[model samples]
Target: MQVFKEKTLLKAAVKAAKSNAKIIGLVPTMGALHQGHLSLVKQALQECDQVIISIFVNPTQFDNPADLEKYPRTLEEDIRLLKQADPELWIFTPTAKELYGENISAEQFNFDGLEQVMEGKHRNGHFDGVGTIVKRLFEVITPHKAFFGEKDFQQLQIVRKLIDKTGLPVEIVGCPILREENGLARSSRNERLNTFEREEASFIYKTLLKVNELFGTKSAEYIQNWVEGQFKNHQVLKLEYFEIANTQTLEKINRKRKGNTYRAFIAAYVGEVRLIDNIALNNEE
Candidate 1:
């Protein structure tokens, strides 16, 4: 696989792919590769002629300095896994200087309602950093399609809005969340958990499933309380927020109403590691 560290070289490579009338696919990641990330790469390979996976641990996305410092960086292992996935996939591993240079100004673009709650509220300016870097990558690659995992369901929603509002030509493809056999969502943060904490973390997905099961009969208020109770009972978990909101706008709903589909989303600290997951409720399907 070809690896380019400079933006100019990467752009040139993408241009050549476009010249040959090849469809381009992009999987933007913050390194520390996992099964979930590889799942996106696999899906990209199926739908596009060439897949480009960009590995840069974005600094702007972290609200806590310590969390940023603790974040995993397993580049050599990540590259080996990608090479195993496909020898032909282009791997763009750029330094922060290569992408951002000297300009460290705050991002100007803002997501309306989507950014105001859950992960956004707890991790201030997190999605702004996400939007800033994603916008930059979309410009550099200009791929026909970009792949993102549903494990980051809220981020996926914000990215979709980013494409819609900016009129970026690339389609934002949301791939399914790949989970462990225990049902815990796969995450780089999962590495930080000790053995007992890892076992406790699976309850987050179980709670989400319980909320989904209670959707139609229970009011949003009751469901929210029940989910909170589950987290409280789990000694190792610290609840950030448990919400039921409109899947499209992400506006929190207080009551269950007819014709409105909602998503049960939660973010919590399991030991020192933060994890987020969601399940869709009351869809026509």
Candidate 2:
């Protein structure tokens, strides 16, 4: 894989590929490639003639400076995995300075109602940073299609909205969340967990399953209380939020069975590491 750290060279490479009439697929990621990330890369390779994976730990997206500093960066191993996946795929791993330049000024973009709840409420300006950097990457790569994991279901929704609102000419594809044998969603942060913590971390997925079970028979209030109680009982995990909301709008649901579709999303802290996961409740039975 050709690794380009500069935007100019990466753009040139993409332009060259386009000139050859090759269909381009972009998989944007922060370094520390996990099975989840590789799933995205594999999907991109399946769909397009050329797959471009951009790995820049976007500093703008982090609400906490410490979180950004602590975020994993296993670049050597990440590239090794990418090379094994597809040796021909171009990997654009740029620095913050390369992508954002030296100014570092805060620019504003309105996300309508999408940015005010869940992750947005917990981590201030998190999605704005996400939107900003993603917009920049979308502009730079200009690929025919872009792939994102549904693990970050809200972020995927915001990205799709951003493309529609901005009229970006790239198809935003949301791939299914890849999980471990134990059902815990694979994430870069999973590397931070110790053996015991990893065992406890599986509770996040289990809690979601509990909520899913309670969806039709019980009220949202009951499900919410039960999920929250489990986190409290765990002691090791600090619950951030446990919500059942309209999957598309993300508006919190108070009553039960309002619609055919609902999403259960949770964000909790296992030690200093924050993890988020969601499950779609399709009441079709």
Candidate 2 residue 122 Cα shift, in angstroms, is: 0.5
Model 2: per-residue lDDT, tens digit, 1-285?
799888888888889999999999999999899889999999999999999999988887787899889999989999999999989989898888888889654457677788899999998888888888888998998999999999999999999989978999999999999998878899999899998888888899988887788786888888888988888889689999999988888899876454447899999999988999999985654
Model 1, range 138-178, lDDT digits (tens) per residue?
Answer: 99999999999987888999999899889999999999989
TM-score of each: 0.97, 0.96
- Against the unseen true structure, what C-alpha lDDT does each candidate score? 0.89, 0.89
Model 1 residue runs over 4 Å out of place are 283-285
Candidate 2 residue pairs in backbone clash: none
> How many steric overlaps are in each model, in order?
0, 0
